[model samples]
Target: MALRFAILGAARIAKPALIDPLSENPDASLVAIGASTRERALEYAMTHAIPNAGTYEEVIARDDVDVVYIALPPAGHCEWSLKALEAGKHVFLEKPATVNEAEARVLVDAAKKAGKRLIEAFHYRWHPLFRRAVEIVQSGQLGELVSAEAEFSVPIVRNAREFRWQASQGGGALADLGCYPVSWLRQLTGAEPEVTSAHQDLEPDGIDRRTTAHFSFPNGLQADVICDMDPEGGRKPPRLELVGTKGRLDIDNPLAPQYGAELKLTLDGQETRETFPRRPTFAYQFDGIVDAIQSGQPVWTEGADLIANAAAMAAIRRVAATG
Candidate 1:
């Protein structure tokens, strides 16, 4: 039986994150959509070829939906995800899973108690480029990792960026973009790191336009992460850099490697470049989601992993406030 997906909101992210993947995943089907209003849902439904459209509550209660893809704003994520879990539907939530760690804990607990597969959709990690990096690092090919750095930045003008992202509303460089580097470091390191020091650049409204933090992992691998949303700061390639005892690895645009990233590995003074097909990151991610549901396994971004990422983000803010 195909797993039917019902979108929880008419969010802009719904297309690349869920709908497009639904169209490609054989085991998944787009059955319905529930937005803040029926008209909005209906409009989105018509645009996406989804069959049913209605209010949020009505869609969750439908027998046709076995899964709920939540594309709501950060504030609404926790509430709606919990509701979906309580309604006996698996949840695929967007990143920063919740506005804070407290809500993440609650929502994760609810998913566990409900015995449903809850995934925090960190789409970048699912891409082959990132997966290959993980393999190299884990294969001992990286050879006793020494340190690493990952950065994601976009140069949207302040006015354009601030309109939707206020710190109070869970909008900031760190919350919105920093989570990726943090999670990437954690994934590659295979252990949680301590936030040794942190800094933030804020707007008049207290939005963190840029945040930089240093972390020290238990295995003696130190790392740095920078998330910048400053327009004047110019653009940055979505990159991750790793240094090990034997050699170094530099990835250009690792975040969306499908779009193209040059993955270079240098060992013993021999350098080689690796490549993966330019399929969208969501393609691999959606299939993993379906496999998790069918096999009764947790997605990579499920359970403790979700809570850990949320807690790490909170720690970054706390450290920045005190530092």
Candidate 2:
């Protein structure tokens, strides 16, 4: 039996990357979609051939819908996720699951009491390119990693209408793009960072426009991440590189919607190259969510990791506020 899903929003980000993949998954069925407006919901439903269209409450209440994907803005994650889980549906919430650690704890508690599965939609983790990166780094081929750098910067959508430009909506480069680089650092090294130093520029509305974070771990490994919503494109690129005692690895398009990409691993200190493609990987995480629901298996980016991320962001926000 396929897991029936009802999306809580007709968010534009869902269309090409998220919704398409969920549709292609044989074990998952896109049964319904809910939007703020009934007419808009119905129109999208008809266009996508979805079985049902209604408000979020109505869709989550439906008995046939086994799962709910909450793709709303960052600020709405906790409310919608808790509501869906209380309604006896597994929840797949978009990244930065909640605005802070306290909210995430509330969510984890709710999921525990209800015996339902709750997952943060960090899609990049599901991609094989990242898995391969972790494999190579952990294999000691990197020979005792030392320092690394990553950057995810794109043109800022500064239109006053966009939620990202609003502080009340949980908007910022740290929560938006920085989350990816930080999560990658944790996943690849399999360790919590000991020290975090950061600098951020806040917009007039009190949201971060640009951020640079430096993290140091216990094993003498260090990493730097820069996430900016305002940039001229050429100065910064969306890439991640890992350097170790042995060599370095360069990954372009670190967060591609698709699971495949070119990875270069250099060894022997001469820029010797090995090219590998990361593919057939998205299903790994999808299956993980199902197994966690059915068999009570533990999940990968859970409570502690979520807390660490929020704490780091909190620190960054403090720095921004002080400046």
Candidate 3:
């Protein structure tokens, strides 16, 4: 039996990230879509060929829906996620799970008490390209870990009405883009990091347009992240580089490896480039969701992971504010 899903919002991300992937997954089905209004929900459902459409409350109350995909804005994540869990539906929450650690903790606690699964939508982590890159570092072939650096930058979306430009809606480079690198650092090191320093360029609206943060982990491991919404250059390719005592690894565009990806490794003055099949990260993420629901498998971005990432982001913002 397929795991039936109802999306809580007609978010732009739903098309490529959730609807398409769930449609392609044999073990998953896009059962419905719930938007802010019935008209919007009906249109989105018709466009996506989903069987049902309604308000979020109506969709979650339906017994046919087994999972609720909470693609609402960051501010609404905790509220809708907890609602779904309370309604006895598993939740697939979008990244940056909530605005702060406190909110994430509440959501996590609710999930635990409700006995439902809550998976953060960190799609890139499920990609094989990243898995291979991490493997090389963990193999100790790179020697003891030294430092990790990641940069994710994109041209600022000029739409004044966009939620990303609103501070109250959890808008900013740190919440929008920096979360990726923070989560990546945590995944690579298998440890939470302490924010040592942070700098940000703030907009008149008080949201960050660009941010650079430094983190320190155990064993003298260091990580730096750079995220920019309005980069001087056109959108630069996202990159992650890891350095160790004996060797180093560089990865290009791990965030959306489906476009194209390259992983380079240097050991003892020898360099090799590894390529992976171009597959959508969302597909792998959907597979993980299906596995966790159907087979009792655990996913990497569960509630605890979300809480840790949220806490790290909070720490980064706190440091950035002090400067």
Candidate 4:
């Protein structure tokens, strides 16, 4: 049976990244949508051909909705996700599952108590390109992984009133965009590198406009990430690199908005290149979530790791505060 999904929010990013893929995935279906704004919700439902539309609470309360995708603002995520779990629905929550670690713990507990699946929507982790990269690194093919570097940034929408510039709504370069590369770094490294140093440029609204972080692991694996919400209006790409004992790999567009990244390998003292082919990242995430829900399995971006990411994010915020 196709997974019956009810989206809790009509997020602007959802159309390009999520809804499109869910529509394409064989195992997933976009069944309904609940928007806080009824007019918008009804319009979205009409345009998308979703079967139902209602308030978020009402959507989860329906027996037909088997799964809930909570794409609300970061501050609203934990509350709605927990509510959905309590309603006996699996939840695919937006990233930064909570504004802080304590909230993440509570949500995880709720999922445990309810016997439901709760997954953070870190879509990049499910991309086949990254999967292949992780396999290569962990297979000893890259010889011993020594270090990695990544960066994700883009100019913010040229409007001061954009939600991303708001503080109370969990708007910031770090939360909205930084988490992308950070999650990728953590996945590629296969360890929670100790966040040794961090820095970020703050907007007057008390949100980060740009930030950079550095982390090191006990195994001598080190990583650095840079994020920016404001950029000059031009095309810029995210950069990914890994250096190992025997060879090195570099991937451009690792967190691409439209396509998968290119994976390049330099080994045998020869430079060879390969393209992983472009596929929407959300498609893979949809596949993973469906497989997990069908097989009674955990999503690859496990809850424990998401909790750790929240802790790391909290620590980074503190470092920024002090500096």
For each candidate in turn, the TM-score is 0.96, 0.90, 0.98, 0.94
Model 2 per-residue lDDT at 293: 59
Local error of candidate 1 at 233, Å?
4.5
Output the worst ten-in-a-row residue range by lDDT, candidate 1: 156-165
| Top model number, TM-score | 3
lDDT of 1 by residue, 196-310 (tens): 9999988788888889999988888989999898745488888899999998899998778877788999999999999888998888888888888988976679889998998
Q: Can you tell me which runs of candidate 1 are displaced by over 4 Å?
A: 157-164, 231-233
- lDDT tens digits by residue: candidate 4, 1-323: 98888899888766755688787777778778999877878988898888888888788899988889888889899889888998999998888788888998888889889998988988878876778888888787778778888878888775665777888888898888888777887777777777788998887778898888887876787888788888656446888888989999898887753554578988988887677656777777888888998999877665798788888788788877786
lDDT of 2 by residue, 56-141 (tens): 88888999999898878889889989999899988888788888878888898898888888888776776667777888888899
Q: What is the lDDT of residue 189 in candidate 4?
A: 70
Model 4, residue 215: C-alpha shift (Å):
0.5
lDDT for model 1 comes to: 0.87
Show model 4 residue runs off by greater than 4 Å. Answer: 232-235, 257-260
lDDT for 3 in candidate 1 is 91
From the highest TM-score down, the ranking of the candidates is 3, 1, 4, 2
**Ranking 3 against 4 by lDDT, winner:** 3
**Weakest ten-residue segment in model 4 by summed lDDT:** 254-263
